[model samples]
Target: MTAIQPALDGTIPTTSSYAEWVDDVRPAFVTAARSGRRFTTYEIAKEHELPEPPNPRADWGNFAQSLVRDGLIEHVDFERSSRPTGERSAVSVWRGTPAARAGRVA
Candidate 1:
């Protein structure tokens, strides 16, 4: 349920298939965050071979922002995305919070 929440203060709904996909991929995202390594959404998706959500453009942002809201991850920097579709655009870089690294988040 929380996983399906919107990106910024619930302005958008991550419902239906996108929400289900977000639920399925959340464990992987949390695990990666817990590693304490800086990463972009593109990198995590590639490393885990995750399937794209119903709306790739908005869903990924929504998911990452949700994690930020949950205090599992924090934005640390920005980097050019590696995904071809990203077209060298800057993407947020994130790492796990202390709570997340200590396994306090789920």
Candidate 2:
């Protein structure tokens, strides 16, 4: 007779576990932002040494979104001009919070 298998249960894994990852990167982000410099998601990820998965789905973007949502960071929009001769497009800039700024001052 063949052995019977147990039924599988439904459960979902979380991506927010990466908040620690975000925290790890927060210092760098704060430092840069406090200097009045803006950072892109890619830049922050690289600075923090975050590992990317084979399949990309805005992990960094989500983290950034969360930061903005939680009032930790502010997003600034700017226009970027095309290379030699062309039009301009909107680009995003990030700014740190008061705490982050104070941390830098200290």
Predicted model with the maximum TM-score: 1
What lDDT is obtained when candidate 1 is compared to the true structure?
A: 0.81
> How high is the lDDT of residue 99 in model 1?
96
Q: Name every residue pair that clashes in candidate 1.
A: none
The estimated TM-scores of all candidates read: 0.81, 0.50
Across residues 21-55, which tens digit of lDDT does each residue of candidate 1 receive? 87778888899889999999878766765666879
Which runs of model 2 end up more than 4 angstroms from their true locations? 1-20, 53-55, 78-91, 104-106
Candidate 1 has a TM-score of 0.81
Q: Give the Å shift of residue 97 in candidate 1.
A: 0.7
User: Per-residue CA lDDT of candidate 2, range 40-77, in tens?
Assistant: 65555455444442234666567677767655677876
lDDT of 2: 0.54
lDDT of each: 0.81, 0.54
Kindly report which residue stretches of model 1 are placed more than 4 angstroms away from their true locations once superposed: 1-16
In candidate 2 the C-alpha lDDT for residue 59 amounts to 61
Cα deviation of 92, candidate 2, in Å: 2.4
